[model samples]
Target: MKLVNIHTLIFILLFIIIGLNTAQAQVWSLQQCIDTAQVHNKNLQMNRNNISIGEQKEKEAKANLIPKITVNADYKYFSNLPYQLMPLSTFNPTAPVGQYKEAQFGVPHNINANLQLSMSLYNPQVYGAIQTTKIASELTELQYLKTEEQIFFEISNLYYNAQILHNQLAFIDSNLINAERLLKNMQLLNEQLLAKGTDVSKVKLQIAQLTNQKESISSKYEQVLNALKFAMGVSIEQKTQIDPNIQFKRANEYTSSTILDIRIIKTQNRLLSSELSTLNKSRFFPSLNIIGIYGTTGFGYDKQPNDFLKFFPIGFAGIQLSYPLFNGTVTQRKINQKQFELQNSELQFGLLTEQNNMQVENAKLQRMVAKKAVETTTEQIELAKTIYEQTVLQQKQGTASLTDVLLADNALREAQQTYLSAVIDYLKADLELKKLTGNISTTK
Candidate 1:
């Protein structure tokens, strides 16, 4: 029986050890998370497909200039041949003038077949459409990059939140350890009649509160981790941990470059400009094309002794030119509308540029303020810890009241919270600044 119990205990211990190791193995770096999301993200896949669609459209527009070939065939049979008018002077040279007779003109059965070919020599619309689609392709690529930047920003924020919660949980555990030690010290003093039972009760209450806080923070940490997993395009049930270590690096002053947003707007402006250009070209330029046809016509008549079949070859080619003489001013109206659109796009570009500039400056200032807070909070936490420790020693030596120890403990907890809050603020501001400056990337 003793041997069986030992074996069971050993198995339980080994199981727990293996579980911990497995969990640790699932830890993902920020780059790993981003790489997986880029590969599996649905939005990114759609944008990539959009780029392909744009390319095909560009090709389709160019195809409009290629020669188009077609074959046509027809067959017809008449029940009776109709009569035609003929002059009465056909038989005699000096017959009565203005006299006429009726005559039939064609065979009863006829067949015709033709092959037609047409190619555009110069078409303003087709050429303009090709240019438009090329611009649209560039626009689609920019949109994909914009989505990528957004995803990176989201994942970074979620990861930062999880790290903050993790550190908060660590702080709770640290407080719990201190509270448990205080409780033991108070209990010893109570046994010797040097401390009251109420003091011991107070320490126990603090411990209980710290334990509750730890539970709450742990739950929040799990929630944040789940959100991070979702942002990374992974299964919600998948077990993963972020890099627990959070570092705050003070960045030097810098101005933002041309971010994705600016480039996208500029691309949009170019597209609008191209639309206007196409409309103007269509209104002024005449379309020119070459058309050709080659075919044969067959006539067949079935009769007792006059049965006959005959086919004649036919071929023709021509150059065609078409200019819009008038169409109720429709093209002119469209041209006016397109010009208005171009003007609006120009205004929008200006607005976007100014807005981004404003945001960049504000983000820079916020990060600076948050960095100062982090420094201040760091020193405050050290001072609070020292105060709490000295008060505990004083209480053990009978120089400090129980109320003083509790107050010091409360101050220490407050300092810890303040420090964590400051660090989070700094991180969030720094992330925002990086986004504005277009510096956020896998390496940074």
Candidate 2:
């Protein structure tokens, strides 16, 4: 019974260890990586923060149209009372008209308190600002979309690179296995005096070279994996594996109108044109405001001579109107400046639209070429493998030289590398086409 209990504990421990490892091993698909990056990427988060700031600015602009109320208080101390001069003849009718009297009045302390309210009734600038802020908020949202598209492209590119590295490593591993087998056979032949020592040495050198290439590819694979993780906003300490299922196909065509960069510039141009219109309208319009105030004036005096404290209430309200008759043509100059800015934005929009069209065309051509290369390399790799196998058999039969086998091996490796490069190119070109069409934001 004791032995059985100990065995059961060991089994439970082993099961828990296996369970932990399985839980830690996670495979992330392309969609999963993009989604995670959208939420966690530092640059994307900063863009989101800009959106929040834009929203708050819009709220502030709207608040400017509402009434503003404030309460204020002030105190003053007078070491000597204020004096006033009066006509003395008013008190005594018989006195001369030039006679006057001087008197000291009021207390030595004073206080004032007030509550004021003011609101704009008709201010063109304020109204224009409200509209401008609304547009600015929209621009910020578009910027976030742009950032998302950029991050998606980066992640896709890195992920494609990692996949290419993985394929290369696999190729190297396969070649290493073949080279080791050939080296072992050569060693056997050399011992039996059937193969030259130089042939055995050459085979051994080939195996060593393949081993070095494998190690180098392994190191590169790890680097690419780390870069993929960084782009996905995943922790470097975590182990991650990408889903190896990738399909290559033709990308859909796109026009300049679908490009995000072009769209963004067009939106900005619209905003600038609106600003110019607002500035022109503001020059001819007037502003009106309503103001009101309610307050109390307090007076206090020391008891040594005259002990008295009094408070008097006051209130008033009125309307004010202001017009910019002329300010040395400042408004006109500002309007001119705004018009220039609008023109500049329009030019930028045009330039960007043309550039994007060029990019779309270029990417399409690249994708076509890569697709063809992939097909060609796939056939070449098969042919190379068959040639290598035949050459190895002929060498063993003493019909082919050792150099023939080496040449076949080199050709196979070259074909494999070409295929990997073609695949990477196709994936990247497809991603670029999607980006140009603004499909990256919606697609996985």
All models: lDDT?
Answer: 0.87, 0.85
Point out where model 2 deviates above 4 Å. Answer: 1-5, 80-106, 250-257, 326-330
lDDT per residue for candidate 1 within 1-444, as digits (tens), equals 999999999999999999988986787887888898898877788888999999999999999999999999999897888798888898667889899888887888999999999999999999999999999999999899889888888888888888889888888888898889889889999999998999899889989888888899899999988887777778887879888898777766655678888888889889988888888888889999999999999998898798898999999999999998788999899888888888888888899888888988888788888889889989999999999999999998889998998999899889888888888888888888777887776333
**In angstroms, how far off is 284's CA in candidate 2?**
2.7
Model 2 CA lDDT for position 65: 83
lDDT of 2 by residue, 1-444 (tens): 999999999999999999888867778888888988987798899999999999999899889889999998998888877888878876788888898888888778899999999999989888888888888888889989888888888888888887787778778889988988988988898899888999988988888888888788788878888887787777997788876656666556654346778778877877787687778778999999999999999999877676888999989999999988988998899888988888898888888777877888898899989989999998999999999999999998999988999999999999999998998999898788778766766567
Task: Count backbone overlaps in model 2.
Answer: 0
lDDT of 1: 0.87
Q: What does the lDDT read for residue 8 in candidate 1?
A: 100
Candidate 1 error regions (>4 Å): 1-24, 73-113, 190-198, 296-313, 442-444
